[model samples]
Target: MRASVSTGQDLGMPAIYLHLLAELLNTIGVDEQDLLLRVGLDPARLQSTNLRVSQPQASEFVTRAIIESGEPGLGILLARELKLPLHGALGTAVMSSRTLGDAMELVTRYLTLRVPHLKVSKRENGSLAWYLVSCGIDLGPLQGFIMDAMLFGCVSMGAQLTGSVVDGLRILRRGPEPAYFQRFRARIPVPVEFGATENALVIPLARLSLPVRFTDDQLAASSRAQCEEALQQLTEDAGFACRVRRVIETSYPFPPKLARVAGTLFVSDRTLKRRLHEEDASFQQLVDRVRLERAADLLRNTAMNLSQIADALGYADAANFTRAFKRWTGTSPSQYRNTWKAAGVGKKTAERVPVAG
Candidate 1:
């Protein structure tokens, strides 16, 4: 977990997801009050429109659900409730977009307002589009399950937006297909590939550009404004650390300087320093955090070398990058890359470690 902050405060993933979990458990005969208590969540705090829970708390909540309900596929099962309408203004913004492409673009832009820990990156090349999904931190036992729900939910929304099964849509998973595939078999229109190099949603570009039947400019604008307002409120609600992270994450040249980051947030350097101090975070800490995330992505996803990565991240040279990488993960860049490269071998061994009794 690179996702877990050094800060002691448990500000982690968004809790809007709890709404769906609560709903799903209620339908399956789980007591809502008991569920809340078991997960160490306060019913009152969960009611806030802008509440966030720690990553450990969320993992425990889902783990408890799976154990109590006897549904290991709980994450995928959550797709039934992930409809756009069930979401708030953010959903409305997506629904009102002019086309599926526009809708996805909005999602990429605004999703952090609801779930800060999930990051969606999108790329387009003529008729092919790649939407890659990743978590800010390792999500523990629920990692695969939660990813399933997210990818499947995206496809489900595509159908709702287009009024038909999306054409030429395939999901790429980083690991083997789970045994519970049949639970949502009919829902996916195209073949899903396991052991994929990347976890992505592949769609024919034309399908995304197709006009949405219910596209309304006025509604789109109004809903988008609400989304903006809500996002601003969320930034305010979450506190200075998140705001600081947002600034660093968006800045180019990888790790931005403290003065530049403070400038973007429209606060004086001293004020920014004071605010972060209040939140128990430092500018240098956030720089390392953002740099670590980018470095990890580059190391895992790109063929960039030490010099290339160092230059891209504004480091002086390969030696500087090596030192930073060591500080971040306790390993040099090449070693970390090798570890990820050989991870698949361990995955297979771990999968078959226990023979069925």
Candidate 2:
């Protein structure tokens, strides 16, 4: 199936990842379907490998999974189950790659297609090479789970590609070791060191030339071509408006100015405006949309007062926020929050409620 990326409102984590997670939860005795239902995700939608779950819903589901299962080591466990073929084109490219180095390069470049929030970069010293892993956004409590899945998944993938662990490979993590590590340590193929400078997979430079077990030059070339096309399509489909919305969504000092947002996106102010205009979007409109979404979430879930919510959304004051909010929703902030509460909607139930435009 062909995959298409979307704007910030529709960008999501791959549903397959969540599908695998739910399976793992079920194996561990958690009622996976109920959890998915509570998060407003249909269980059957995950069957399609190309489908994606919206970021908010995915986050909520994952958070609840960890809490319900009480398995902080879920990521590590999930890594073991991620066979090469499950990774789609990137996996095919890696499997057909001529050398270990070639496969690593494909992964570093195309990982965002699978895990949008994580980035991988390669660094080489005199004798040792490191694939440094980092996240694009603040994942908060999910940071460890993501890091574990990524770093450990790399270790598992290496063994799968080469049919054995690469010589002198190890894992380096930034924080102190978690208590759950001892249970899974035997399952990991390589030594793992905690309290390191960064999260990375370390390997000897010479091993980079090791041949992949199933290397096929023609297939590798074709698969690499597919990876290139997929990457291009994903970026193009995001569109200029989507790109601008992404910057606005993640911007610090919430509600950044036009020039700042443009600079962050590596475009001049005029170019940014023209491109967004071509996409039929305005900067202030996009900012207001994001603010309104956040405002709704705060109103529905948090006990924060209007002043606090306004300040969090970068409004000048509560009065200004109330005026803009009324313009957007036809009700004052207090009224909105009160009405939401009066409906007896909690976090889990609120996910199923359709938002009125």
Candidate 3:
């Protein structure tokens, strides 16, 4: 019941990033060593198509490359290298999308398949302003390195489709780069903020309706059915924990305690035990897993204290919450807060545990 998205199955390496990286390096006259240094990629791992790169690594690759290459106007540099129409399978899919909105939906929804570690979100800020937000755990040291390529690619594709420029394009980076602000305009006339809310692409609402060549009930139905089937299979495989996570997400601000959750699912407390038994999970185990995930997000994103967090998570008291937090992570809430505070990372709760359907 949690309104969260997940992959039914993990896809292999993200071809988009790899392709873009190859093109980008070639365009800039940067080789494997340059890329390896930028992305923190091991030389041996670079050759494998199946090797996965974390979002952080992708970010690092782009961020560092700009700094190291002395190509302050890096977005334009990479944009020049991208052939938006040549994205092959991905391009074909977008070309078939019904509306620009629909095309964007498909791309972001399936971005995980292309790059499993990166999560993308789109939000309407005003009548004509929309933000395409991308965030995820960085792949070690390569935080934000590939972002320049990815953002430029998006803009390039937009321009190719409309044969014009986006009303605005910008970036919110992890750290300050004095030259980047000037370079941003040279590449695209959008206002660039160094430490903005998140990495996002701004688009006009009018452009969202621009016609794309791709659309068919048949394709939509098939894709939907395949996605549904895959999700169902994953849920079955993960068993009760999946259901429990779903339940927690859906029940946010009123997350069900064990007894209440069991009651609503049409099972007696005892029956709940038996079912979880068959699934090789206990109610407490499910709860703990959900709580740990939720806690991680909160610690990373919020200033809520131990007591407030504990209370929010349905803990009996601050002490109880601290004990549980220590168990879930190796450190206590205070220590975690102190470390991240020193490191200058913002905190955010992952999301409420997902509730079952």
**Candidate 2: segments with Cα more than 4 A from true spot:** 1-11, 239-357
Provide the lDDT at 234 for model 1.
Answer: 66
Q: How far is 199's C-alpha from truth in model 3 (Å)?
A: 2.9
The true-versus-predicted C-alpha distance at residue 216 of model 1, in Å, is 2.1
Candidate 1 lDDT over residue span 57-97, tens digit each: 56667888888888887777787678786677778888888
Worst window of 10 by summed lDDT in candidate 2? 1-10
Residues 85-163, model 3: lDDT tens digits: 4443345556556677676776676655444446667778776544455544334333243465566667776666555
TM-scores of all predicted structures: 0.61, 0.65, 0.47
Candidates ranked by TM-score: 2, 1, 3
Tens digits of per-residue lDDT for model 2, 1-357 = 222222232345677888899999999999998887666565755755655555555666778998999988998999988888888888899999989999999989999887776789999999999999887666555567778887888888888888888879999999899998999998787999999988898989999999899898998889888889977877675677766765565444577789876764556999988988998889998998878887887889889999999998898899999998888888888888888878777555444323347
Candidate 3 positional error at 280, Å: 18
| Model 2 TM-score, 2 decimals | 0.65
TM-score of candidate 3 to 2 decimals: 0.47
Candidate structures ordered by lDDT, highest first:
2, 1, 3
